[model samples]
Target: MSAPDERETLATSLYAHVLALRAAAPDAPLPPGGLPLPRGARPPRDGAPGPRAREAWPAVTTLVRSALADADPVRAALALERELSAAGIRDRHVYAAVAALPPPEEARDRARALARALTRTGTTVTAVAAGLGLLVPLGEPEDVPYLRALGLLEGLGDRAARALAPLDRKAAAVAWLVRERSDALRPLVDALVRGDEQAARALLTGLSTTPRDLGRRQARYIAEAVGLTALLRDGPGLLVPAFGLLARMSEGPEAEIRAYDEALTLYETVADRARELPPLLGHRARLVTLVQELDSGDARLLPWPPGRRRAVLTALLTAVGEPENLSDPAASADWRRAEWVHRTARHLAAVTTAVEAGGRRAGAAGVPPTSRLRIEVAVGDLGEPTGVETRLLVDGRPLVPSVFGSGVGEPPETVLLNGALRAGPQPTEVRLAEAICTEGCCGALYVTVRRDGPHVVWDGWRRPGAPPGLPQAPAYRFDADAYDREVSRAERDLGWAWPARRTAWLIAEGLRERPGILARWGLRRGWISTDFHRPDVTVITFLGPPLRPDGTPDAEAATRQFLRHLPDDGRPPRERAAEALRRLAEEDPRRHPEPGE
Candidate 1:
């Protein structure tokens, strides 16, 4: 049968099912199978519409109301369908129009019928989105399957989530979507545990068995759902999963983890629970992670008072046991070589003597026992065939691994000279080297740079999200004055400049001197920068939107203008750059080459 005929049959069947169920038991929850979908071919993809469309299309409400005013039910439905089709998911007012139908039972019933029909048999994602929005206040439990099935479609998860929000069984509906798209996990768990006592317990209980690897962001949501206050109150009642949650919490961004109120109490609770529970291998692995985080001195355990810190450390060490004594041999071996285990053995004194005067051990001369010694970035060939690379040199030895190099799309000047050593008032992390594939795919070496009195401290050493067993750099302290001089000297010494480097340098200098030039092209000066993508050419890059949307020239236009005017030759960089900038300033993009032209 034709698509329209199939949709008509499904709509008719759905109406019959709802009426029969209502007649049989007026107050009973509707069956899951009440609304059957049309079996027609799937609709074409239009990306999910965002709230921007609602902001842009201010006339959406009037159009929707006009559609709904047709007196004949068939024509009203047809008119409403046209509005949804025209506006699609873009016009959110379409949904608001149906929801706001004047509340005579007849008009509301008509709105409900229209929503059900669109949800059941609509061909396009927009129709589905419109249906979902309309149903936000009016959807019955029976509409869930339609929501779930269409929500499983690529672009409909958020729309489905909103529609499900008003239903009694929202948790089940939301959970069904989350299983298919883990991105929606936060809202699901948040909705479940928000202020409801029984629901919080159920959420925690359900999360207890969930797979440990939900990626960092999702795991944090789970922790936030089972918040510190909730955990402190209810944590003792639970066992293993609480430990799992704590372990995940330890791996989160340190600032957020530290913000967990009554942290000392929470740590003590976890330490006590570790001793009480049977030490399964999973628990052991999690324990090792917690212990590792505690020992790292990267701000996790630093905030606690010496007495409290000592007590927690003592409890954890006693509970975790020596790696050699572990029952599982493979697990034992893994823990034996682990960084924290080694650090604990060496600094067992600092932890134990926390309450004692001068108990902190001594380090190499001029360095605190707790702080890693200072290091410096030294430029060297180190085997890359193209541009120069950088490595962290500690005591004249290459400390960072050779595998990390200046990856494509970033220039060495940006990576090393300016970016790495810049210290802010707050502790800041700078990626010293990225994986050959780039920072996103494989991890990068990030050192936290902060000022400590007369010296600048680079202490929190991490290879975040990197695979296990890459070399971890120790923290370093350097004289702030000397560090500044070295960076300045490095900046002035331009012996490393090749053709690509020279071009990038010129563009950077030109932009830095006259920041207003980018504004004429509708670009933010802060967003603009330069990269040496190849040895032969320099590419201008943007950290954010390259151009404003008001019919102005974009990054590509800037790049083309610069490339056409600037050429590699014996001419000085400053001279050539000035010439290029002068020419660029003379042109008017608005009149010559308009937006989208």
Candidate 2:
């Protein structure tokens, strides 16, 4: 085929892949490190084009027309640099001006000639980058070597890859660049998804050794590409890197692993391979890390059903806990040993104890082997309607929206930790995701959390007063010890803590558990709400009151107290929260109600 025809064929394939991805997930952002959607003609954001740019547009067009009309490589290269500087216009705008002109059949040869000359001799890095950009619409197979050579220069790979995006041999050129520059993984993905097994292997090798900071930036895109699965079937040479990449993908966010279609299959493969293969340093630590994540409510593993998660965990334990593996003197020298090996052993032992205590098999107790619960605070986007709330992730999926209808957010962390997960022997009904109404009439979903022998179970889904029907959710049974570890871990995670949220939760907890604090002010019922003005400062509002003659809450008569500004103030959140609660308990409403109240 002609070079132009081959370029067109490659471009069509890439376009088809992008369309397939969009069809599969219309709402998701395109994976980073993948083919970028066309950015179109907007000027760069860092600075607007100078006024001289608009004035120079006609001159820029005449220059491009004359250059293409002449079809002389030497003159075209000289005119490109001279005219662009003289016109005082940007290269992108020049490219746009050139693309706008009607192309004659002869224009292809002329344009390619200019593209070659400009790319070959362009003086500045910026000029070379701009020359490559021109080839996006006009690049052909023969231009591949020049693109590859230019791409070898530092920070030029992305631009070279962009020009190569529509050309045949794109995978080979991109794969080569990636081996030299890992940052090129972003564009390498564009080539990998079109059934290029070579590019897939190249990507795995780059991801396996890339620095952690860069690996994280590339993780989600690595997960999105469909080609990596082929490496699993290739051989053990790639398996080690595959394991390394999986460990990285498991970090940061649930979305990274969730985006990967083959996650479960890969986990299963890793587990199966662990029992058969001799332990290597990479395999030992990476497998242990995967298992540790699986144990501590990694979100996906704990909730995985039919015992696949349990089986994977068991296989990992057998692999990592082998006497020969642990006895190695170098074990202590491994940096990740303390992080993964010790923790994994403890968790796996606990899981084993729980499973064995239930009976010979985990199923005997009606609980899966590695099942655990996670109470995560999901902070909605600022200015969005969704507010901060503690949510339940059964395994890795959200339980709130699935059970309660869509219009709900949970109570503060204090309310949930105090009432549900840590509730005593008698089942406790905790207020879960509720309607967003201010008056509190729309009602909320409640779950009964109770202990059943070796398991902690969440059952008895109910939505009282505001609605008659509730969505069906299974009774989640988690091993008691694993459940406790998760709850304790969440409580210690002050990562989510801020002065305002802490104060509001403390006040809310005080009111809910100790009604006398509110009753002392002649207020029988109260509601707690917090507005975080910033990360450090919050406004905790207590609303409730003296009722009207009709026995309904009279808004005008209600006690509206604002603990105006609770700043970080160099105090521990607990200390600050306690002081605010004490002040609320001591203040006399009749003598010192809020000014309007």
Candidate 3:
């Protein structure tokens, strides 16, 4: 019902919220006073008086006292009030309790006197009181005047003072100081010079649209103080702009060379002061041009001690001349005559240093160097005897090995492989092998060798019976020993029947003499051998008259039906024949259903 009572209720709610948070996170630090004061009033003061003695008590003192009491509640009721405040629970009854306190006429004057004393003395009490007034027990806008009069705004760090200023007045205060008190910018300038990045950023942002002269002066002061010639070269913004200015200066004639030289010296100094900045590439190029204009033997044109001169010369040559011939023939003689060799060596040394520096920087930044190789293989038509070749790619490069072979027989067959390779800490070999063959036959074949693991695998040929044009047998696995044994058996069987063809007596006397059988089929006429298996499907063209049983063609029906069904690609003839039988059964009327009956 009353203001004080309402404040108490809010305080109790805040207290309860804090308690809940603390309970949830046991390790969390307890809130100040272990509770929050009421939203619009301060906590009760100790040893001063109860509600019966207060009159016009300062809102800040009241908040501080109440918070202190809640932080150290004497009674369970007080503790409960704190918990309620922390939890944000409000009660009009708390306001009613405040209304019952002594009239303001009696207490207000005394509270002000005590607050003023504390503020002037700059005691912890003043800090607490100021914190309470600014942060809690938010009172009327007029209350801010009363607090400021007590000197609460004096003797605080810029950041802290800014933070403590009334939210609505902070921007206006900053604007007033920047306009009326130009010297106020000194702190900001000093901060920048000291490399206090946060302060410098704040100052720069605050005066973003200010005069360029002021901004440039501020930046220059900082650059000079911090020896940031590079920043000066870079110009205007965050980086030092001196190098950029020097580069601009260097563009004129010989008379301007002195100014350019001075700028370079400053740049070198800046570089020494800040080890991070590299020598300006543009500046280096200009130096090369100057050296080229001068006589080669001019001592002043040279850099310094022999080594240093060599380094400067090398950098200049690198900037202006063609690259060194690393692959030159008459190597020693050519290199001895090469004017740029010394410079090139110096440049290379610098490069090595730069690389080392980069590595160190990366290490410091906690970035790990990457060292991994990736291999990709595309295999096609795996199962068929006329299988597709595999292309192996390593790190996106096509590797062309001088010697590649498949260990299938006495003399290994040359195989084409594709891929790339990179030298590693140890030699890494990537072996590409097929794992399964589902093309010509229903069998698995695997090829293996010891090498680095293949990274990417792809199929170029689709398996038989799969969607047409889709990759089928990407890889196959084969047992080399078993494959060799099978090959040996096949060879032996074919070899044993080889000479049987030459024995005409054995063929005519021992076996039935059938001239037409041999001639009609062309088995004898053609170089046909049992060792080679024909594809299941064949298209035989007859150029002559069709043969009869007696080796003669009947003129009436000379062209007879000569359809020979063979297996499809990758399928055995027997399997094709079985499939054909199924097709025949389905075609028969007995096995078919009448259409639309």
Query: Which is the leading candidate under TM-score?
Result: 1
lDDT of 1 by residue, 1-597 (tens): 988876665444222433444456653422222223334223322775544544534455555455446555455555655555554434244445434444345566665666676667555444555566668777888887666545433345456656765663333343333433443244334344233545555555556422333443344444543454456556465566666666655541222344344456667888866688675544544564465345432224346765665567667766765445434435553432233343333334343343244424332221122212223222111111232444344432334432222222134566554555666678887766666565677666776889988888777876655676555556677777766544444455454454445665676767777777756655443322223223333444422233346645464643332222233454666666666567556653233332333
> Predictions ranked by TM-score, top down?
1, 2, 3
Candidates 2 and 3 compared: the better one by lDDT is: 2
Model 2 pairs in collision: 33-186, 299-395, 299-396, 303-395
**By the lDDT metric, which is better: model 1 or model 3?**
1
Top-lDDT structure, candidate number: 2
TM-score of 3: 0.16
For all candidates, the clash counts are: 0, 4, 78
Residue lDDT tens for model 3, 335-411: 31132333423333443343335434222211211111111111111111211122222222222110111101110
TM-scores, each model vs. reference: 0.40, 0.38, 0.16
Which order, best to worst by lDDT? 2, 1, 3
Off by over 4 Å in 1: 2-5, 9-81, 87-124, 127-177, 181-238, 248-269, 280-282, 292-318, 325-597
Worst 10-residue lDDT window for candidate 1 reads: 376-385
In model 3, which runs have C-alpha deviations exceeding 4 angstroms? 1-129, 132-154, 158-368, 371-597
lDDT (Cα atoms) of all candidates against the true structure? 0.49, 0.55, 0.30
